[model samples]
Structures are given as C-alpha cells and as structure tokens.
Target chain A: MADRGKALALPVTLLLVFEIWARSAHLHSDSLAPPSAVLAALWSAFADGAILTATRDTLMSAFAGLFLGGSIGLALGILLGLLQPVDRLMEVTIEAIRPIPSIALLPIALIALGFGYRMEIAIVSFACIWPVLILARAAVREIEPRLMEVARALKLSPADRVRKIVIPAALPRIFVAFRLAAGIALIVAVTVEIAINPIGLGAAIMAAQQGLQADLMLAYLIWIGLIGFGLNAGLNLMQGRLFGRAALVRDRT
Target chain B: MTRPVIYWRIVSFVVAAAFVGLWQLIANLKLVSPVFLPGPDRAWASLVRGFTAGDLASKLLGTLEHMVYGWFLASVAGIALGALIGSSRTARSYVAPSLEFLRPLPVSAIIPVAIAMFGLTQTMALFVISFGAIWPMLLATIHGFAAVEPRLYEVARSLQMSRLAVIFKIALPSAAPDILAGMRLSLTVALILSVVCEILAGLDGLGHSVLLSARAFRSADLFAGVILLGVIGYLTSLMMSFAEARLLGYRRGVL
Candidate 1:
C-alpha cells in the first residue's frame, strides 16, 4: 500500500498542479489543455461514440494486417528453419530487405494501392513480418537435437515430424513473436493513418490538431495510449495463461 | 563444415542473381505498369541520377543530421535521468511506475501532440524524435545501474569515493553493454521518427522527397529514395555493431 501511494504521488501532484495553473491562468491556448478539460473532452468523446468508432477502425486494420503478416512469417520462418539449404540461400536476400523501414515503403504502397485500408494493411504487414520471422526461425533452430532424434527414431514422415514436433516445440516462442508483431502492427497502422490515410485514431488526432481542439487531441492521444496499454496487458495475461512462467521469462530479453 | 560454408555462399549468390533476373524480366515484360513497378535497373539509375543531378543528396544529409542530433539528445538525457533514478532507491520507486505506464504508449501517438505544441519545425521533429527514442535507453540504463554489483559500491564506499565519481567510473562501464544495446534501438527509433516527421512536416529530407514523388506519381524517384534509406539503415546498424564490439572489447571471451 505504501508502494502504491509512492507510485501515484508524482502523477497526482503533477496533474493537480496543471489543473490549478490552467484554471487560475485561464490560458485558453490552442495547444495546451487542462487536465479537467481533457477529462471532460474524453467523456464527451466517449458519449458520442467517436472514440469507439475510431478504435474499431484502427483495430480492424491492425488485426487484419497482423493475421496476414503473422501467417506468412510463420510459414516462411518454419521453412527456413527446417531447410538448411533454403535458409542459407535466403540469408543475404532477407538481410538486404529487412533494413528498409516499413514507413519508407509508404510511398510505393500508396502509389500501388491508393489510399484506405489496403494501403495501411500493406505497410503494417510489412512492419509486422520481420519480428515473427526472425523470432520463429530462432525458436525453431534452438529446438533440442534429441527431439529431432526422437522423430527420426519413430520413423515419422517429414510432414508429421514438423506437425507433431517442430510446431509444438516452437509455438510458445512463436506466440511471443506474434505479441511483438501485434505491437508493431498497431504502431505501423497508426503511423500510416497519421502520415497519409484519413481513418482511425491517428487521423482523429490529426483532425483535432488541425481544428485546434487541444482537449480533443489530448483525449485521442490518451485513448490511443490506453488502447496500446490494454492490448499489451491483455496479451501478457494470455501469454501467462498459455505458457505460464516460461513466457514471462522469455519476454524480458 | 568449411565445404558447406562455401556451398552456402554459392547458393546465396545464385539466389540473389535469380531474384534480380526475375525482377528485370518482369519489368521488361511490362507485367505491371512501369509507373507503379519500375525495374531494379531503373531504380539504380534513378538513384544515381538523384545523387548526381537532383537535390537528393542534400535531403539525405538533412535526414542524417536530424537523426544524429535527436539520437544524441536522447542518449544524453536518457543516461542522465536513468542514472539519477537508478542510483536512488526512493527515486526509482517513485519514478518507475510512471515510466511503466508511459513506455508502452506508442511513440507515434505523441507526434500529434508535438506538432500541436511546436508546429512544423525542426525543433518539433527533434523534440518528437528524442521523446520517442529516449525510452529504450532510459530503461536499459536504469536496469544497468541498478544491477551494478553490490561489491563495487562497497569498494567505492571503502575508498571514500564521491557519488559522482563512483557513477562515472563504476556504473557507466558496468552499464555500457545495456546502454549500447538501448542506444542501437534508439537510433532506429530516431531514424523512423525523423522520417515520419519529415513526411508530415514537409521537411527537406528523403522522407519528404519520397512523399512528394509518390504524390506526383514518380515511382522511380520514390523507389530510389527508399533504397537509399534502406542503405542508410543498414550502414548505421553495421556501424553500431562495430561500436558495440569495440566498446565491450575488454569483456571479449569472458562472457
């Protein structure tokens, strides 16, 4: 309880100071908003369903991109991990491509796919793929040699070996990869919206900024942060439930 | 093992060649519009032409300048604050909760706030970039300093070493690896935020150039800008790894 009080002291004091200053100064600036005003803005936005709608749009695109990218990365990572020759052949190519920031692909994607969900998903997918691919490949490669020996001893076919042995062994790490990819997907999706696409929470922030609605803009920013925090917390909970202490241990690095 | 290593190199070379060959073939065949999907040769040509005749070099330099500046600021600030928090049990307990709350907030979300406060200016970009890039380094520094061997502090106390001296001599070197790792991550974050800022603010950088070319439907120029950014990213990471190896040289083979 004392620790909890210590944690809240700084933020609470800071917010109270800001609230008093804003109220006393009557600083109706275009950029700065008081805590109380921000709270009020958040409340109204929620009542009007604006925040909910923007969140839905953002989540839809983010999840779509994550699913598409995660699957492709999983397949490619598994193949590369399982096949020594293929992994060797692909090393240089993957390295060459991986350094290119996904945001840099915005221009190409925009020109090719035009504005809207398709373009945003393409960029998010591009961003999400690398983490999964790299992590999954590492996880697969790190599997115990004895496991492969067991598969061979059982005379398991190649397909069965992968299905029964490789996947199960690697699933936990791969799930961690997906969690990382999920974060990337949301970030890239918001970035796409902020940069060009006019949908979702990022677009809302941009719109509010342009309108000089500081309270609204802050509200949206806070909302997005909350969404991100919630997503991470939920994933952590799921990972804990699924993999127990093992997932938490792997996550630190 | 050596034979397989040579074979792997050869296979990699062949695969790369095939990829370029296929790309050129597709471009020549006009399977996709040249406007949208230009050949690799065209991209190479445009890259060369942009450097020689166009203002691409200046834009590239501007981006590098912005990225380095922001990254430098983040490193200094993150290290200082991290040390202060990490060295004190009271400060760490109070500050850590706020950091935990803030860390997961996507850096991109802060862009709008920065823009609102500072408008479309280099100062805004620098602020946004530093703010975005600071977290990894700060966390790493805190972890590093806090995890410093208790015996080291005991020795410092025995010698009557000053607090600042103890930190500079003992904490900094001990924390170098974690700090370096965080710096590497922050550099990437700096680059990404710099690009995002340039694109949004119409700054004179490769990002703005790419955005402009795309808007004008100049696919080749856009691709060239992208390729250049990729090279920059690759080179920076390469340099960082070298720096890491050099800085941590004393620990070589010990781990």
Candidate 2:
C-alpha cells in the first residue's frame, strides 16, 4: 500500500497531467510552445552553434566572476574573522551595504564599465561576494579556540596553525558557502546578461522573447535551468563525498 | 595598530568620499563625457528633481506594491507547505528531493515561462518574485521545525494534545529562528526579483525607470534609481532584523 501510494506521487502525477495538457491544448509555437516543441527547438538551437557560443560566453563570465569574487570574499572574511579590530571597524558598513542587492549596482557598473562582459562580470562578482563573505566570517568566528591554543602550545607558527587548525575547521562551512555562492553567481550572471542585453544565453532568450519565438526562449530557459541544476548537483555530490563525515562529526559535537 | 584601525575607518570613508569627489572632479575636468558619468551633485539634483516631479515616487510605489503582495503570498504559502512537510517524515521524503531540485534553478530562467504563461503584466512580475522568495522561506521553515527537540514532541503526544495545538505550541516556537532567517532571505530575494522582473519584462517600476534613464543617457536619474533601490533594500533588512529581535525575545530565556 505504501509503495502504491508512493508510486502515485505529486510530481509524477503533475508531469503526466502536464504532458496530457500539452498534447491536448496544442500550445502556440510563438508564445506558449509545448514541452515537446521546446525540446526540439533546444536541439535545433544547439545544432546551429547558437547554444554553444551563448553558453560559452555566459559560463566564461560567470566562472571569472565566481573565481574573482569568491577568492576575495574568502580572504577578507578570514582576515576580518581573525582580527577583532578589522571586524569591529567594518561590521556596520558591511551590514549597511550588504542588504543592497547587487542588481542595484547595475547602473553604476554600466556607467563605469559600459554594456558588455565587463559590466556583467562586475555585477556577478558583486552579487556573489557578500553571502560568501558573511558565511566565511561566521564559520571562522565559530572555530573552537582550544584548537588554536593547542597549536600555540606546540609552538606552531601562525601560518602552520592556520593551515592545520583554521583551514580544516573552516573548510566545511566555506564549501557550503561556495555552493550557495555558485548558485547566486549563476543567477546574477544570467540576469545581468539578460538585463544588459549581452551576447549570451540571456541575450538569446531576450531576443527570442522579443521576436515572439516562445519555443526558442523556452529552450534557452531549459538550458539555463539544466546548467544551474547541474552545478548545484555537482556541488552537492562533492559535499557528500568530501565533507559528509565532517558534517556528521560536527553535528555530534 | 589602534590608530591604524581608526585610520582604516577614516580611509574607508575617504575612499567612498573620494569616489564621489573624483566623479565631481572628472565631470569638471571633462576627462570623459558627462553623458556617461554625471557628477555626484548633478545626480543628487536630478534625484531631487525627479522625486519632486513625482516620477520617482510612482515607479517606487509600483515596485513596492508588487514586492509586498508577492512576498506576502510567498511567505504564507511557504510557511504552510513547510509546516506540512515538517510534521511528517513521509512527506519530507517525498517533497524534499523535488524542492531541492527546484530550489537551485535560477529564478531568471523561469521568467520566460512566467511571461509566456502570465504575459508581461503585474502577474508575471509577482509570479517571478514569489517563485524566488518561496524557497528560502520553505527551507528555513523545514530547518526550524526539524530543529525542534524530540522531547517536546513526546510531551505533547503524551498529553494528548491536538496535532494543531502541538504544532502551534511546540513546533512553531522551536522553529522561529530558522523561520525568521528564512524570511530575511526571502525579503532580499523578493526585492531583487521584483527589480529584475521589472527591468527585463519592461514593467513599470524603479527598475524600468533605471533602464529608461540608461537608454536615454540620463546618467544622474539612473544613479538616482539605483540609490533608491539601495535605500529601500537597506531599510527592509533593518526592519526585518528589528522585528526578529523583538519577536524572538522569548528565545533568550531558553538559552
């Protein structure tokens, strides 16, 4: 009975119903193309090199921003976490600025950098940095002082202590922050590209929408979704493989 | 070192001031075109003018309305669903995977579908914002409820408390922190999504105004809109934090 009930679950049922609706309603190609038509459109878009260039451009900008922003955020977070004066000095200002959505910086970025990859990259980096910085700082602050004391007792240098005690202790949370930041980076990247009308997947989707090619737009949307899902899934898998035991240990403590 | 810390604060202030002051200097120097990057003074003047002329207010109100409506609906729905799922392990097993799948999908990716389904209207904007806002609330609620002590549940069950009563009396109080954190996240996402939807869909809001100013090369007005968005976002977060502190005062007793 339990198996039967589980087999008739909500998502599967919804999917089946949606498929039937798609078949029956005959959704319009220009505005509301069916999923089947969207899949075909996706194939055609991929075959034509439209998907390739756009995907590459989008990924490149996102990756560049992610690396730049994540590294800076991690370094700063650790620095502030270690230094009480720095944390105290920066706390209020960071709090004030942090709430301002990175999208709000679009106009300034555009004015300073112009409407291209540079502007998109700046926006993505700004958006991705804050959450990661916050998480990393918190993770650092949460590190047990006893570990640091033990390292000091052993006459370990600052660098060695950081490497052996701080990094390993903070690594799990940092990775979690990275996972969160990756999702945010991708989202901001796509949105910035779309808003800026750059030559990327976002641009393609906007173009298709403007041209009233719903099928093509839907295809682009699906591709972006798949990319986001793939990244997130990959991160989740990595977390399970690397830090799964650490997470359990932390929980127990 | 203490002086350097003070100096660093001063330097940060100077850095921010110099950024604006340099803009004024550059504008005066005509190092580049004023059409692209207007001075701070001009931007402030334009902001005042735009507000006095009621251009800024209307657009701000439009965005605010959508954000409030969308965020309200998302929170209510998210809390309800999260509670339902949190109450039962079977429900969690069934829904958690699907929620996880959907949670990571960029909200922007769904805008095209939303626009297709709802058209380029307030509904589309609301739909997009709500979709983005819901995840944080849902996840927070799940975390909050899951964090509830098992002993409390056992006590409730032994007392033969009604399920609803148990949830209200035991589950909710335990989960309040997680729920508040979730709401804070949702609030930020809602604001971001509201602005993005307005910009991309060409809807009537501060985002659209920013895009309009940019296209017209009205750099001051563009900056003004950005400033307004920043102010609104900052205020919203402040308000949320204050509310959380006030409402969760009881939790300090437990700790």
State which candidate has the highest TM-score.
1
Candidate 2, A76-111: lDDT as tens digits: 888888787777667656765677788878877876
Candidate 1 lDDT by residue in tens digits, B30-111: 9999999889999999999998998889999999988999999999999999999998889999998889888888898888
DockQ for the candidate 2 complex?
0.39
Best candidate (score: lDDT): 1
Give me the candidate number with maximum DockQ. Answer: 1
Chain A TM-score values, per prediction: 0.96, 0.88
- Per-residue error for A245 in candidate 1, Å, reads 2.1
Tell me, per candidate, how large a share of the native contacts it keeps.
0.73, 0.42
Clashing pairs in 2: none
Off by over 4 Å in 2: A1-9, A25-34, A142-169, A211-216, A247-253, B1-36
The digit string of per-residue lDDT tens for model 2 on B87-203 reads 887887677767766777778777766776787888889888888889988987877787888999999989999989977899888888888888988888888888888887788
* i-RMSD of model 1 (Å, 1 decimal): 1.0
